[model samples]
Target: MTQEEEKKKQRTRNLVVGGILFALVILFYLITVVKMTGTGA
Candidate 1:
């Protein structure tokens, strides 16, 4: 593949992985916050 094609593929993969990681990080933060608060939310 050409450089452009390779870059496009890498960009797509980065977006997908980044989205998953963002979601997991949000979930982790929320869980920790709830645990610390003991709000049982």
Candidate 2:
């Protein structure tokens, strides 16, 4: 493959990994909030 194509592929992979990480963080945050409120109430 060409250098430009490799760079593009790397960028796309980075974006996908970043999105998955972001979603996981948000999921964990929501779960924690629910657990906290559930026990507090």
Candidate 3:
């Protein structure tokens, strides 16, 4: 409930969200590559 604790919590949340977004981007990139190569069929 302290200011420092709040900042730490916010930073952790931001990192987790950023990581999820990054993983989704990589997943989409891989899917696109597979589809373009006609290997997904």
Best by lDDT: 3
The CA root-mean-square deviation of candidate 1, after full C-alpha superposition on the true structure, stands at 1.9
The TM-score values for the models, in the order shown, are: 0.67, 0.88, 0.95
lDDT of 1: 0.97
lDDT of 1 by residue, 1-41 (tens): 99999999999999999999999999999999999999975
Clashing pairs in 1: none
TM for candidate 2 is 0.88
Whose TM-score is higher: candidate 1's or candidate 2's?
A: 2
Residue 38 in model 2: lDDT: 96
As a TM-score, model 3 comes out at 0.95
Go through the candidates in order and give each one's C-alpha lDDT.
0.97, 0.95, 0.99
Runs in model 1 deviating more than 4 A are none
| Residue 39, candidate 3: alpha-carbon lDDT | 96
Q: How well is each residue in 1-41 modelled by candidate 2, as lDDT tens digits?
A: 99999999999999999999999999999889989889735
Clashing pairs in 3: none
Q: Is 2 or 3 the stronger prediction by TM-score?
A: 3
Q: Model 3, stretches more than 4 Å misplaced? A: none
